[model samples]
Target: MIISIIHLLSSCQDFLDEKPSTDLVVPDNLEDIQALLDNEYIMNRNSDMGEVASDDYFISKQEWESWNEITRNAHVWADIISPTGRFVSWNALYEQVFYANVALEQLDDIVPDSNEQVDWDRLRGSALFYRSSAFYNLLRIFTMPYHLVNPELGIPLKLSADVNKLVKRSSIEDSYAQVIGDLEAALDLLPSRATIATRPSKQAVYGLLARVYLSMGDYQKVLDYTSLALELGNELMDYANLEQGNTFGFKRLNEEMVYCSYFSSGSIGYSSDTFILSEIYESYAAGDLRKSLFFTQAYQDGHVKFRGTYMGNLYLFDGIATDELLLNRAEAAVRLGNEEQALEDLNYLLEHRFEAGKFEPIAGISGEVLLERILEERRKELVFRGLRWEDLRRFSGSQYEKTVTRDLDGEIYTLEPGSPKYAYPIPMDELQLNDMKQNPR
Candidate 1:
């Protein structure tokens, strides 16, 4: 079941590059495989490549000018020509995929004793989860939007540790199928809950299922997974207990956290020169705690910066959380005409987010209006959490259709919904070496 590179490339190539054929590095025993999954280098979130492409952030012209060529191209929605110029996340993400495949491929030879079965299953499940996570995000970033998915090749589905397996892009449909298949396989083998946020438990699996189904617009599926996730890990951080004026109101591995992974960025995007949408930032009711808890006035005049990241620092946190599951459930419930359930879920999260006694439950809303309100709360609550780009993509054809435009030095850079730009060009180096066809924009 192992698939990896068989051919040798130039000496300059890194892990992302295909190289001379070599035997797959199978771990000798269960603990070695456990050690592989424990390698956070592959498990943790990579850089802010997708975050920079997202609508939530904007950098000044000076910042843009100083970026390397690839970065600047990506910043402006230009087809990237030099991958070295872009953030190195693609290489980083795939490295995780390859290592996960290594662990999974090695598992076939191990015969667990009666007492060893539990740990064996957990290790296999963890490997699958890690592999599935990497592929899911890769497809999200590099492939075309889901609705447009067809036979056209998406990112390569690297399922083996053996370097000899060819890495060719599968069709978008096949890509999703593999990802879902992997995740489904991982679910039963995982523990009910992981010991820590970094590990995959049944809770993280369900949370991931919600995210996957949400991306595919399967509201009922999203609701089902979210409900299952909350059944296990639904602790919400009450604003009443939060300490204000800190960089993060929520701490690492808090109850609300199902799994923790983070993206990284510099201070430029955090600055207020390009401000939060006044309307959105001002939408918080007087008693809402997020406005104060998540933001601070930037040194720039009339601008504000985001202080609330679940990572509790400047790095962008992108992991699954209970609050996100609630929002997903609310949105999906309303979409499925479960208004009562939607309201119940929304009220629960909103209650925790707003000042204790000042929080008033939303009432009398129904249908699309109720859905809009839920979606609005989602935008307000999850800003800078690495969901915006996908949100923009998913809403493109709906009434929520967005056309993102940035004014930089009097010039406008816009990313339109349904445009070819929506699928960022494959890295130039990948196109040069692989059989994969570049996205025609």
Candidate 2:
């Protein structure tokens, strides 16, 4: 008998003529599985509640300095302990994982003759990739240093499709182990490439492994995975070929992007106006096309207007890119004490950024200096790509300082790390629902 499903927001219930679990069901066939996978992609595309609250992209500009207060208290990301902030991020991330888990649980039921075995593997791999991605985000935000050897505090590790059970938090090492395990499995199952950008491929899995290894402080592993991703021919987008109104005009993600989220004006619910820090802008030398290609200038009543600057449109199409792999390789080279190799990768990136013959290699640079330069390039290249906050947390103890200065109404305000409001507080509703421990103020 044919059954219709009524998708509800909160609970799953069945009607006489309808199927249970309206939002999801055990696929009767391969086409049903494909449809369910499409739903997972939809979740990834629309999951912006976390990104909107994070500081990777836009912050309260001078016009709305007071808005910073709202962010600082409610969405300002510091530690993963804030009930409101953590709950929002945690719940959203888990929700994505839930969709993935449900899809994975139903994989074996599909008839092999009706579905290509490769397709089944791809779907399973994509589901695992999404789950790992969500968990990795949680680990970066909630846990302390991943390289702490043995971390006392780590985020909870959720693995099953069942949501009724209460899951306790795992140690940092355990969480990383699980994340690594998931990615490795995903790598084995995913295809090398796909016809569409929304799906995760084998190369995307490798890209994630490179990022995960970098976070774990395994430079060699980072290098290995990054090199594998690069072999896929995901070259950096040459700004020279870019034209106005090109949907892929911005440098954040393009053919180079391994996996990315798509963003539009209506979906973002915020102005696209982007302001580059003057110091960062000044760091770019003459003839560097990134300064012009990546940003636009507007002058209004003596005040500069930098509106319509796209900061890695998340909702447009999020994917892995070669640029990140290049940065990862450069950083890995530096860590591996290969100063020359690191410089080569850094210069390769800069050469593409600047006009031909304008790029030059620095002399007498040590590994440490090369490392710094690579990071600086990353800061410039990856602005608003959801990498800034994670970069802040990963390199917290490094020379880089987490600070932003704002001039508002004749008063200057400076925000620094370790401030009483570094991390956001957990939401009140979460505290009421679960007896979970809150981050110490």
Candidate 3:
């Protein structure tokens, strides 16, 4: 009987030693836990949210129609609400949130003596950074302007890993507060740099904070964070180095990039095809390297295909760059009446873009003129980088009369600020599942 019991115990041990099914592998140890970070990084790369939020894409088909024809059908109509489009902007972002929560939850179980504990901390910080970024995008799309100060009308904040639980929408204030909290926590934990581009570092956290504060209209905070990010990030990519098919890529974590992610051939189409606005092409000055490096004009049988090539794509890189910090700081300075500081940041970007000593300083420029010049410079410098629409929306209160024109089925449509459809409708799913209020169109 005792021999039989010993044999049974041995059989049980053997059963436990066998590999578990894929679904059963919940990252039991430090190594297993590290895998979650890798998985989340891939999810971020493949997410459609980035493209959807890009200036090249529109929140609504109507808005697309006002921009241009190719963009009208491809992005506005087909990419936003179609079955293929499927509100990816919402779903993909929330998916990252869920994954981030899962990683954060498991991080505490990792022991310091474990070989992977340091890696575990890095992973945790990355997860939190992603979580904050996802929510920031969601808030940008789903909620009204942060300046509204209405908590009752914010987005649904998902803070946990449980997919089964129902989540109600939080106030806009609460959602942003949560985003700030997560980013701050991430900043405290993330490294100054990492071997991989996908992971967030302390500089990435600061960059994110600057963006968030800019969105919130907190110019002081924006200036502070933007300065910190600029100090840590590398210099801009030199246009002189760019040649046709040459690898003149921006260095990761160099002065230009604070944090970055990779996208091979598979992840190329969305931003490359859809985001470059026709007006941007028309506005490009002759002899500008940006017009050459950033876009290519192709003609076929009287039809033109204006293909945009982001420097990020050709170079195996994508991320928030420090130039954004310059723009943010400049805009904040303009808002705060520090015109000299504003001009300084603006000229800094222009000097870099125009090659050394080519950019001359504007003399005695002020008021709306300086603002307009800054806005135009921003349009030129930041084109195809996914910022135009948000800049329009965030500064809507300024009553900028910039018009967007697009062609749909050969019909031209015009969109101006103060249109009833300026804001997007809450997805029907959210309306059905939660009692959240929708934006009035």
Candidate 4:
């Protein structure tokens, strides 16, 4: 098992404490710059706070009482205090932004010859994509949902490598604009496909844009971007082909995975104490391959837990994938009143997830009903992929809005739609250092 930074932090408090020191050797060459971008710990890891707060899994009352503070508070939507005495998610995401800025700044000085142009462009394109991805994740967790009325302040747009400089939080609109702008710039520079899934490609940028536009309710862009992405690759993994008896059935960098990344393994991640919610487990019909492939009743008490992570192990995969693109395209199509196309995309994915002879295409659905079906599948198909939190935020105040609840020690805690808690309180460490406005608690 490749224990990611989230796990490393559990034992190493100073693991990510390095400053962007000017005293260190500067990366002046293309190879040096590429090396910085290739550091998976800095670039591929994302915050898991959203996943911990989401409704896909729960901790038993006894386990909740025995777990760490971050785990207990995150599950109940309460204010979280990092066990390492630092907000891991906030610091880790910003660290990615910092690394990206370093590469981008260094790239300016090196003029690649014709022979090196391709590599140069790929490095710069990758940097832009990484920065944009980091910014998007930060906004989703620390800032208000894009659809909220006069959404709260956005996260700081850290564009430069200067550690001494402080950039205050921008308005929510401007923050999203920055994310979109960087992605658009990356599209022209990136190749149609990358040699490795860890690297971003044009298809990955399109998929991410579709996600961003969906959060902003720009159905047309979501439809357009997803269309372009799907045209490049729309292959879904056949769950029936996976070894159901294996502890983790899926493999890392699977064909459907356009960009491979992982999020933090929070205190509740993949533990015996953390069991899949009954509602979520039962939603998968008997013939649905996901029921067996994505979960297991291997616990001594027979509680079902997720073992089907795309990373092929306990590390949570939270990167771009074709399945998510298909769902995005389908949802956008239905929202645009093209139910036929929407169902075509939705059923295509479903066919591969069901038992060979048990699969049936969905038809005779239209309008709001069809839209609801797509959303429900989105919840089931992308469960534990760190997307449910964003979905919950975007669905707030809409017809699809839901009030998620948690039961710990016989007390129920609820997270209401459109609540300010949707945007977690900005870490006090950041506020104290930067003097930026704190998000409303």
TM-score top scorer? 4
lDDT scores of the candidates, listed in order: 0.78, 0.61, 0.62, 0.85
**Candidate no. 4 TM-score:** 0.94
Give lDDT: candidate 1, residue 201.
88
Error of 2 at 12 (Å): 12
Which 10 successive residues of model 4 have the least lDDT summed?
11-20
RMSD of each: 5.0, 5.6, 9.3, 2.4
TM-score of each: 0.91, 0.80, 0.78, 0.94
By lDDT, is 2 or 3 better? 3
Q: In model 4, how many backbone clashes occur?
A: 0
- Stretches of candidate 4 off by over 4 Å are 1-20, 80-85, 149-152, 298-302
Mark the 10 consecutive residues where model 3 has the least summed lDDT: 300-309
By lDDT, the best candidate is 4
Model 1 clash number? 6
* Candidate order, lDDT descending: 4, 1, 3, 2
Model 2: per-residue lDDT, tens digit, 1-441? 113222432222232124334563466665676776675333454333333343433333543443333333333333443423334455666766776776787886665654488778888888888888888776655455464323645665667766655666577778888888888988878878656556788888888899888877789999898888878865676666666454334644356666655432222234444344566666667877766665554433222222222334333333467778889998998889877777777777777777767767655787677778788888777654556555654554556647644443444555454343333344456556555555444
Residues 1-441, candidate 4: write the lDDT tens digits. Answer: 347645755533443344545465668999998888887867898888888888888878887877667766777877555544457788788889988998999899889999999888989999999999999999988887887735448889999978778889888988999999999999989999888999999999999999899889999999999999988988888877877778788878889999999975546555668888878888987699988888876564767888778988778898999899999999999999988889999999999999889987899889999998999899889988989999989999898889998877669899999988898777777777788787765
* lDDT of candidate 1 over 126-192, digit per residue (tens): 8888888888888777776788654675788887775556688888888888888888999999998
lDDT, candidate 2, equals: 0.61
Off by over 4 Å in 1: 1-26, 81-87, 264-275
Off by over 4 Å in 3: 1-24, 40-42, 46-86, 114-117, 148-150, 245-255, 261-278, 298-318, 355-357, 361-363, 401-405, 410-422, 430-435
Q: lDDT per residue, candidate 3, 241-260, as tens digits?
A: 55544333333345466566
Which regions of candidate 2 fall more than 4 Å away from where they truly are?
1-24, 40-42, 45-87, 147-152, 244-248, 251-253, 262-269, 272-274, 299-318, 361-364, 401-428
